[model samples]
Target: MNTGRVVLITGTSSGIGLAAAVQAAQAGYTVVATMRDTTRSDALLKAAAEAGVTVDVRRLDVTDPESVAACVTAVADSYGRLDALVNNAGRANTFATIETCDLATYREVIEVNFLGVVAVTRAGLPHLRAAGGRIVTVGSTRGLIGQPFNEGYSAAKFAVEGFMESLAPTAAGMGVRVVMVEPGPVFETAFGANSGLTRESLLTEAGPYRRVLEPYLDWVARGAHPGAQTGREIAEHIVTALTDPEPPFRVLTSDWAREYTAIKYTDPEGGRVRAMTASWLAREED
Candidate 1:
């Protein structure tokens, strides 16, 4: 039990972040569970209570620099050290082609998904360095292989992937480990609902892209595939990455995720990935 070890997690109002907070506390780490609004923290608190674990719930808006800095500072001041940081706060983009997406929409996704990670990590690095800590990010398979209509989200996650991959070796040299946990389709999460996209809405907005969007939506509604996981399942992977003696740089949540991402690793030329994703948007007659 890591009684004195402290870990800060963002976006704990629901889903993966909430699960991670509860599990981390159960693992005996002092968990600081944060969300944009403290008013939304009932779920996290209740879960922690039910599990007979205590979590220090705080308000942290990752997109705001002041909020990020203040939260990290407070945690360090109160705990004297930070052992780990989980970059889990993210916003999903609506299902739309790049051409159809407005610039503001793209910016919103980037702000919360990519830059939010940057701000929090930057603020926590000093304390983390002192503790020789770790940073675990919740990434998606979309970051490895872009989807047809999720350009904004995929782009943001891809930026995160590049930034973390480049920072890993240098961080390791500093006695800090950085890991990315990649999950495929996650079930029982607010992630999909937060996107604010529905079948009718997407079809109405598809306009010129309807021909392609239809098949894409059809493929999505076909129900869960082997690669789909629950919030708890992904959270388990996050906790394992945090606790493992020598975790890999990239941790895929399930066997299906490993196989799915293996396509990208093997296809350096990008042909196989393109073919596979394209099949999801294929026309009925094709």
Candidate 2:
């Protein structure tokens, strides 16, 4: 029962992207799983095998315009149509306050997280419009509520959320659906491992900010948030966002994530979220 639908996914080498590729393939979509380097695709291949499905692997570095265009072209040529696109390629930044974070780190995060989606979406638009397809981007809860040490990553996701919102109406008119899947903490993922980032590396000079940074770091060490979701759980929501006839414009990965983001709407002035974060930073040891 092949759906005859083709979906091109970015960053499929591991974690949520890999899980979505396998799930989409098992659900009968012709899955084009792409990563910056195909050399890291063993995990994806193995996952697909375990799921008793096959996915076409390709090289797609979202940060590179040439690579993005080539990958989209190759998927269109090889598959004849692209029915869906999952914009999931991203990089986590070193935990640092804006004052301490390097400009280069911010640039790198924005290039990959925000501009990468722009590039890939630009290339895939014609094909998607032709197929009346869906565009699902993997965003983060931090996009709605800023966190202590996630300034750069959150900024990129905030841009993504805004970009998608601006594009959705026009795309709907052109018969393309746009969606964003926002996830909270994900477990058993290597996203931050290779980012060449650590909290310690970010604090070269403790200065006066150490007081604020110390508690957040201590909280994180004691489990930042309990009951974090796994990559597979987030991927499931992404699959649903793609396949549902009337898919939601925003899909938060968990109940907690949804509740957390809802605070923004409850208080548009940013008072509630600000207060909550301040409370977290001010909490004393138990």
> Which candidate ranks first by TM-score, i.e. highest?
1
TM-score of candidate 1 to 2 decimals: 0.98
By summed lDDT, the worst window of 10 consecutive residues in model 1 runs over 218-227
lDDT of 1 by residue, 1-286 (tens): 6579999999999999999999999998999999998998898889888999899999899999999999999999999999999999999767898888788999999999999999999998898899999999998998998998999999999999999999999899999999999999999999789777789998998899999999988988887366899999999999999999899999998899989889999999999999989998997789
Which regions of candidate 1 deviate over 4 angstroms?
A: none
Q: Cα lDDT of all candidates, in order?
A: 0.93, 0.89
Best by lDDT: 1
Which tens-of-lDDT digit does each residue in 53-167 have in candidate 2? Answer: 9999999999999999999998999889999999999997567777876799789989999999999999999999999998999999888888877888889989999999999
